[model samples]
Target: MSTSLVVGGSGRTGRRVVERLLAAGRPVAVLSRRPRPAAGVRTIVGDLDDPATWPAALADVDGVVVCVGPPHDAAGAETVVHRGVAALAAAAAERDLRVVLVSQIYVTRPQAHPAMAHVTEARARGEQALRASGADPAVVRPGWLTDEPATGVRLEQGDTGWPTALAALTPDAVAGSL
Candidate 1:
């Protein structure tokens, strides 16, 4: 991909993705409701919740990487995660661009944990939207994020296990997986 719009590039996970993309000598841009990237990276400050806010054909943009979600504001759960991502996915699909969406482990089992209820329900919808939108998204499912040093890496598919990794898997490692 020539240029990929990174959602939540200012946040921990997306920041790591942006840094790695830049280090690889790739052109990087971010789509955010607000905030900007470091110098040299293009920043598109817009809220995805607004359908009209989606930018079109800027700099031959070819892909997207979404790393935005909870530890988020529960109030904006539906708008930000589901509706917004769905719209963005549709836009990307229309352009034939691939999308890499960073989702969480609890999405499949929505009511399993009360603490993540909001995120669970919303992310489920977001995943469904990406699928239905035909963005050909690669969804990364992680668990409760901790800033502790990444001790190991593991991948399991059943969506039933420890909520997180063996040791607190750092954002850096998670980004590496991407």
Candidate 2:
């Protein structure tokens, strides 16, 4: 069976990725700082600051999905997503594994919202690093997420929502897209 490593597995998108991967009969491993239990998914405790734990979590994995978001501070955001994503890409390159990275839509249009500058910059940097790492990356740029449940969701390419679009997406909707 194929194996997948999901970073930020407990977060909005990460958790759903874990669930979907498991449902597809793939071996799932979740990498997070505060690891939690999820049926059918193996949880691995770790963080981006020390990627040493990544090798173990990524062992024999066919693909890696980075769904981790930036931190509150600008520098921290860069470190966690940009630098951390670069590290994951490097690791996947060494093992010849595919990668799927989650990025926000606003990052490309910084002028759309003044408050989103730093985050958008950080996400753009992360995407750049992944593209440079020789890993065939599937970049998912989602719109404003809605917690309004997943009864009906429409996933499309490109930026569909804005900073205040308020069109939140449930984790299941994103999982379905994947």
Candidate 3:
């Protein structure tokens, strides 16, 4: 069976991704700064800022799903989002592993809200880095995430915004898409 690593597996969305993968019967590992023990899942403690910790979690893994997000501090967003995701993409590329990056919709838009500009910029950079890594990765850009129940989902390409009626997407819906 194929084994995959879920980066940021302790976060809200990441947790859902882990559960979805496990339910699908895929062997999974979680990369986190703290230990997260789940039956049939392996947890590898590591920091995204420290490159040395990557290989151990990635070893023998067939793919990776990056669910990490930028820190609240704008200054740290670059390191955590851009640099961190870039590093992960590079390492995954080296191993010929498939990569799925969970990104935000319209992150590169010039009209993004001022309060979220920094994070959007960092996410945009992360997307660029992943594309440049020669990994042919799949990017999932979810609309504002919510805890609402999963009604259904749709996939579209290009710069399309979520309908005004659909205010947010549930983490469960996004995880299932991955």
Most accurate candidate by lDDT:
3
- TM-score ranking, high to low: 3, 2, 1
| lDDT at residue 82 of model 1 (Cα atoms) | 89
Angstrom error at residue 158, model 2: 4.4
- Candidate 1 Cα misplacement greater than 4 A, ranges: 56-59, 70-75, 163-178
Q: What residue runs in model 3 are displaced by over 4 Å at the alpha carbon?
A: 163-178
Using lDDT as the measure, name the better of candidate 2 and candidate 3.
3
Better of 1 and 3 by lDDT: 3
The order by descending lDDT is 3, 2, 1
Q: What's each prediction's TM-score?
A: 0.82, 0.83, 0.87
In Å, residue 45's CA in model 1 sits off its true spot by 0.8
lDDT of 1 by residue, 1-178 (tens): 5887787887878888898898988888887766554877888777767667565423477778888855455768888888888998888888888888888886777787887788778888988899989777788887657766675567776576464454435787666765
Per-residue lDDT over 1-178 for candidate 2, one digit per residue giving the tens place of the 0 to 100 score: 7679898999987877887888888899888998788777788889865779877988878899989877867898889878888888888888888899988887678677777688788888998899999987889887655545665545666665653334555575556755
Model 3 pairs whose backbones collide: none
- lDDT of predicted model 1: 0.77
Cα lDDT tens digits for candidate 3, 21-104: 999989999998775799999999887666898879888899999988679667788888889889988988898888999998
TM-score of 3: 0.87
